[model samples]
Target: MHGALPATLILLAAAVLAVVACRQLKLPALLGYLIVGIVIGPNALALLPNSEDTSYLAEFGIVFLMFSIGLEFSLPKLKALRHSVFGLGAGQVLATIALTLPLAWFGHLPWAASVALGGALAMSSTAIVSTLLNERVELNTPHGQQIIGVLLFQDLAVVPLLILIPALANPAGGVIEALGWATFKAIIVLTILLYYGQKLMRPWFHMVAKQRSKELFIINLLLVTLGIAYLTSLAGLSLALGAFLAGMLISETEYRYQVEDDIRPFQDVLLGLFFVTVGMRLNFATLEQQWPLLLLFLVLLIPLKALLIFGLSRLMRSPSSVAWRTALSLAQAGEFGFVLIALAHGHQLLPPNLEQALLGAILLSMLVAPFLMQKRDALVRRFVASEWLNESLNLTQIAVQSMLARNHVILCGYGRSGQNLARLLEREEIHFFALDLDPERVREAAAAGDSVVFGDAGKREVLMAAGLSRAQAVVVTFSDTHMALRILSHVQALKPGLPVIVRTFDETDVDKLKEAGAVEVVAEVMEGSLMLASHVLMLLGTPLNRVLQHIRSVREERYDLFRGFFRGATDDSDDPSEQDQPRLHSVLITEEAASVGKSLGELRVAELVEIKAIKRRNIKGVEPSDEVVVNVGDVLVLLGRPARLAKAEARLLEG
Candidate 1:
């Protein structure tokens, strides 16, 4: 207990100072944490000598980090990004290994050691990459998604490689036979999880959430995360694997988002410790003795790994800028390399000098990563400017020359929904131009005499080329919510009063889209549910006109009928032009108003007009219920004809 106390205090002090220094410098806090680890580590000041104890506790950092990542990636989301997660991710890992194997062999390492080193070098730092991307608010960008996909695969690949490395040292059994047995064990564990894990998780969380206790919720989160991690460790996989599976199970439950928010503070703190532990393992003495050799190796390794990633990304059809960013962002050796190299040394697969050299290279590379990422955008613009400009110009020329039209509808995608929308517009003799990323689709559409261009709709040049400045309306029909939101922001900034229509898959994004100046957001799930309800009512012998009227009433209520599915949904009728209102007035409650301190029910608002919604500072509000109290500075939405609204506004002022 005495020993533990000082270790904890030292870590806390170091972490605090590091965070402050990094903050003051306007650098990422991760670099500060790592520098603290290196400065006070056993090799330096030796403030904490118990490396074993710190290492054990620090391992939880990766576990919780992997769990949070799994929470963000639900099954549906993974399916949506399968092209990156599986295709590009798998290709990058294999390609890295293939490229590194020859170099490892030429260094005079044995064949088994070469394979082990190749696997070790194939990984990129998820902890650093994820933190940097989150800090930069670029995790949703195309290259950011690519990095995430490859990092996920690298994490998964560690489990098998960890087992295989030790097996290669003493091949009493055939190497293939040992690998097959390990693979079978892993499959069994995963199969068991796939079949029954989510079922058990949902009910467990439901009961916990019923209690509505924050303490209990946090306790349950730790129990489930650590417990699952222990189980996977028992099955011979990495602890991170179990935590990831636990997160995936919880992801299927309604409480996933809440759990994520609750666990993030813990994950961030623990991950800081993990990086510190990693830095502590780097011995400055070994690095000093081998500085020249290590420096040469580091120089060679970074560029080669980056080149491999770039080539593989291009093969996956990523744009040149995106591919370059992804490559540079992941050009360093990963945290997992330390674990692999340690395992390799334990199995006698690597010599002491070689191990030291590899460690020095990896630590230096990680130290350099933050700076590279900070300059990533500038580097891309500087190096890839010519090629990117040529591509942009070619696409813009094609779009304007072949498809541009005055007062035409500008479509932001040419997917299934986009094509359908274009056909309807064509039937009405309305001209349209489309921007899509799928080159094959663009070629086919152009050959069919339809106006379509190959380009990302989120680009300013692409929008301008599609005649966004002159277009009568802009409609975004893609389901990529980030891209759709980007296009919406761009168009709104260019033309604030333009009628922007957005199509989304569900209510998850309806309010956000509407707030971003979308004139209307068509939610597929809500519309489908409405259609099904109408059919059921008709089958029950309700008159067609009555059924249609009921549907219209439900929709007119802003789908309040479906609020049970999506809680805390606000009234969207605040926009005047979107509604069939003669006038929609936004009246601010004044301090002198008689109603300022009164309950909404006392205002006799029902007799005057409807209280559509209310906005307050720092709160997500919907339509005000009758029990709400009127406050000064509250913005109230009063909906009625022009004259009635005028009287209501006067009364509000008087109140």
Candidate 2:
């Protein structure tokens, strides 16, 4: 017990010092904690007496880390990026494994070891990348989103790889039967966890959460994380895998955020311990003796992996400027390499020297990760300037559409929402460039001859590349409020007084976004108000002239209204445009019985509206031309003066 006290004290002290150092240096605390472990480890100070205990804690940390990742790794996010995460992710892993296996075999490793090394090396550090992105405030950036999507797919990849490992371990046995048994156990465990664990965990968490005791909350967190982790491992899987499952289960509950908050302190501490243990486990003696082998591996293996990533990214046709940097950033070995190598050693699947080589290779790669990420730009520049790296960089720059003019529009995000807005802008002859993160969408738009910029709006560099520095007005059509605010702030900082319109999925985010400098906020809930204000005034028997006047003024004054909505007591900046006289535009679609079969051109809507399109319910397709007919299920979308739109509704709809 007395020996335990010194160990505990020393560990705590190391944690404190490392945390402080990390904070001071603005680096990730996890890296600092790892350094702490390396310093006090047996190779260094030798303060820790029990290596086995550290291993157990490290195992627990693995469970908790995966669980936390699962909690944040939402089903909703997956659904949103399913095509990329699953499609690209699966392709990358398979291609890497297939290509590397023969090379490994040629290197004199057994086929199983070759495949195991391939699987281990193919998986990147989701945890490390996630933390790094958060630390760098890049989570919502296009590159950040892509990295995350790819990592999630990588995590999902672990499922198949897990099943494959044991089969490879027992090649003589009937592989199909072993796979079936393994799958059956996995399903039973998953079903029981889904059916029962969820049922019990939430109410139990609620009760614990209601206690309002921080100590109890921390204990509950560890219990849930460790308990499920233990249960899952008992069913024949990595504790890390179980932790992820447990997190997903808990994520379904309302208490998830609370659980996350409560787990923070424990996560921080245990995560530090985990990294430290990882560092301590590093066999530095061998590294010091065979520095040449270490250098050779770093020089040979790192570049090979990086080149593979670059080629894959190019084959996928990621952004011209971004692809190389992305490959360089993620090309290094991740935490899974350690797990796979250790597992192989435990199972006697690999020789000790080989395992040592892999471990040394992995640690060295991790040490290089921060440098690679930090110097990404310089590396990119160097890669572009280098004759060796110039092949990939010499590819075409992103095909961009021009949005040049005073009052030129800038549409950020080319998702479904942006697409709809672009259609409207097109009909209006509004010259605007649509910025989208998806390379495919950008390609699609380019092929279609639409003006689009394939870049992230969150980055000042990307935005500058998109001509946002000269944009007359910027419109954010994506749903991420944090990202929207960041764009808004940057736009305002770059060109003060630029009118920026932002879209919000809910009214809840309106005040926050507006306060962040959005000139106008369009919450989807208020969409009906555009139609509602017209009818309500007509029903009230207000003069049509007055009604039209009110609606147009609202449309024009909305920007000013939002601009001044949050001024504090001492703030004297009132938007002057809100005080302007009302102006109205009326659109009335006349529905004549005879005009129903005719398109807008035949109806000569130009006599009523310069622009209008039919809005179809639950569908996305263009309205037919004058030569084509309008059927019963269409609604005319006419743009004109308030009175004109109201007056021509019948003519527009019928046409």
Candidate 3:
């Protein structure tokens, strides 16, 4: 409507059009926003006459974005990832600086400029990587975790680097003096914000928010954001970084989720504008002139950075695939790179030409990153099938061999039960691998070093992962009889000689499982009945020992009948006297087992059975040497040669 009104309206129109078009193309809305900025940029269609104002607005967007990051930051969350966030993060910063400083100097920049360039180039874009990963729902993946950790560390570097650039221009004092002063001021500001902001900021927000008006809250959010930004600037740190710190402080409060949700719209709009402004900074003339150099740099930059970050991830002992994904996710420069470069230029620490060149590289890299991430799994598969990823196979195999190798246990399902089982296994010193259908579960478990993942015990491919070929014992927690049969069939195919303990909720699958080579088919209903029977007996005034004996008899009788008839039904009737048949010794009574009311020495059953391990529902660990005494409900890991084991098991069944 005014001087720049028509042009401004046109740019807004282009921004909307770009968003709609990008949605159609299935690209990020931010990419479309950038397209709008580039199309209307001074160097291009020139639809927008006010380029400088656009840049300022874009700068505000970064402030808002950083503030959002701060609000989300919690001391506990950071503490949880401290090893990666601080240790790995700091290492990446130093290593990147060390690696790139020489390269920048070789490019003919002055030492100070070289240092600035090195710092700027070493940083990768967290915003871009996060957006893509979230879109793919892979943020929960191992690589995703590592990527988030490293990016946080990279963001942590931005504040100091920004301060350093401006301080580098001040020749009156040495670097150490400037550094000390900067550090002191930052500490003061941080301490003041945490100590004072917590008391005042929340109340201030409540007072402002009570107006129950959106505009009031928006104004408050802005004030909190820019107010901190302004304060941080006066304290010799970047306003964006300061705002981030303030947001983090407020994030810990009850109002944080509301604050984040409330300000999210503004953050998105501003952040989008910021990316567009960045895109507008891409000078096509230079890209055309130096496309070759830019391409070479892009190729070299991504691989080199990826290699460094990957090595850092491995140094953190992050799983191998996770390390690669993190490296790839962060191989390109991030939004903070823009912030740092802008600060450097503002301080005259970096020249305009370098900014333009690096900006072009970064923008191009960002545009390609999502595609790369989407294709990551495909790439990993190819490499993993080859010798390339072979050398870096995650602990899946190692875990299988270590704790899982012997008669340990094979968890047939990686659901809630399986997860708990593994935790219990750790304490009991029982080696086990969790088998499941979910890839993310496997990845997450692997990252936690549980080495339990990525297999459906139902599938041969999955069994191979669980090392079913070597596993001494197996536990199928999944209760679906049909699925159990399918899994049992597959497992038996792989290891016909291996003992398989199949879990089922129905009796229909018992004969099928035995025929398929399962050593035992455990029906949930049968176990429950015996447990209920024993509990009822003890509750009915039967002595605990008599109750224990009764339950033991029941399990032995049921198993003997099942094992006998199961084999007979399968045409392998070796034992016809189902009652006289030797007890299945594989079933041992723990201190808590129904037999727990009895003692090994009291039962004189040390000669009767072997103890596998003891599991207490209350505790996750095993005693390796569980005490001879019985406890209430203690799961006895028992092994008897056969007849004694079955008889010992029969003791549980006695009425």
Candidate 4:
């Protein structure tokens, strides 16, 4: 018990210290976890003596990680990026395998072992790439989307690879027959899960939801995840595969977000444990003895993988910069390489020395991952400036169309909602341009002489191509919250005073959209509820005028009653624009402003009108900081008559 206490202390202490060090250095915490494992591992300080326990935790880590990955696996998203997913993704995997196999064979590995090694090394770490991309706020970028598409295919390929590995291990007993049986079993299990499992899961989730017990929901989630994994194990497939399938099944239901929110804390901790286990398995003695060999492998392997992925991206007609960034981002050997090597070693497929060497090589690649990704922007611009220009040629259609329209409304997402809006605008003799991703929708709309272009609205170039500068207003008609938020940012940045109307399915995003610069957010859920309440009031002997007044009151308060019932005071903020009569205005002080270092009292805006609260970026808001010196990023909230407020706003802006 005393020994166990010390081991626990060592593990916790090392992890904390390493994580702090990495955070201070602006590196991912994953590297810190790996370092912690190495320090406590048997090959180093030997604080942890039992590798078996770590291995068990590591397996569960992979399961939860895959489950999280599966949540993002929507059919619509796949269909939207079919070209990249199928063409570039498939090409990257097969090409890397083909490239790596010959090298492995040249190193005197058996044919079966060579193929397994190639496949293992070909995969980049989804856990690492995704975490970094999200943190850097690049997940929605074109290259970022391509990287995810390729990673999705890589994750799906793991199921077949899991089966293939076992067959490779038993080649003497008719590998083809073993693989066939395993494949057949996999198909049957998947079919059962798809056909019946989805139906059962929806009701199970509904039942859990009805109970309204958070504990029961969590317990049920664990049971479903583990049960599916156990079933897959019995059918001779990996537990991670089953867990991923379970996530996919849950994703089709409404309860997936709740499930994800609940599982995240567990997944993160276990994933750290898994990386620690990988670190523990690293033999530093071998690395120290063959430092040059490790360096050689890193230099050769990372570039090879990057070149292969880059070539594939180029083949798919991606811009050189985007292709280069994607290539560099995924140039590392993945976590699965460790799992595959461990499994191969267990099956007596790899010699101890070879396993250690491969481990050293993989760890080296992972160590360089942060550097490669961090410098991705600089690297792309430095090398691919010429290709960037060539890619701009494809925007010719957008340019020509945009030049034809001036003072036209730019409508994003030309779906049903957008089409309806267009019809009304057409009847009013209003000129408008629409941008949509669906080729069929764009074509159909164009045939009817509607001004529509095939492009992503979130892209700045696309928005510019839609003549954003010449637009009277912009309307976003999509239910995608992130994309809508991004589009709102672009619109606000380009034209701060432009009236933007955004449509959403529910009231959950009303405030966020408003803050993001949407002049009006039309939430269908809130509107429907209002209509229902009006009808009920009229039927219950209430006056029609009174019912209408109540609804009007609710809108005047910005649906405050609903917000108070659901969201609470956390959403509260004093916006001067919401005031009656002359609207309130907030102006941000910039660095070059003449009043950058001046206090509110010095600005003397108080004489003209009331100075409301001042909010500093990355700091708490203060109530009328009269004596407080104004910083570059400080937001000054002012309310006055329109004429006086306009002068005050100009003073702040000029300053």
Q: Quick one: best lDDT, which candidate? A: 4
Which portions of model 2 show Cα errors greater than 4 Å?
Answer: 22-26, 131-142, 159-180, 198-218, 317-319, 378-655
lDDT on C-alpha atoms for all candidate structures: 0.76, 0.67, 0.68, 0.79
Task: Please give the ranking of all candidate structures by lDDT, highest first, separated by commas.
Answer: 4, 1, 3, 2
- How well does model 3 score by local distance difference test? 0.68
Task: Give the better candidate number (2 or 4) by TM-score.
Answer: 4
Greater TM-score among 3 and 4 belongs to: 4
**Model 2 — TM-score against the truth?**
0.59
- Tens digit per residue, CA lDDT, model 1, 207-312: 9989999999999999999998898889766687788788878888899899999999998898788778766766778878878878877997789888888888
Stretches of model 3 off by over 4 angstroms after superposition: 172-176, 209-214, 381-655
**Residue ranges of candidate 4 with Cα displaced over 4 Å:** 9-29, 66-87, 130-146, 170-221, 231-238, 241-266, 312-326, 367-386, 390-580, 585-604, 612-624, 628-637, 646-655
Q: Which stretches of candidate 1 lie over 4 Å from their true place?
A: 24-27, 127-145, 166-177, 342-349, 374-388, 391-655
Give the lowest summed-lDDT range of ten residues in model 1: 561-570
lDDT, residue 645, model 4? 77
Q: TM-score each candidate.
A: 0.59, 0.59, 0.60, 0.67
lDDT of 3 at 535: 81
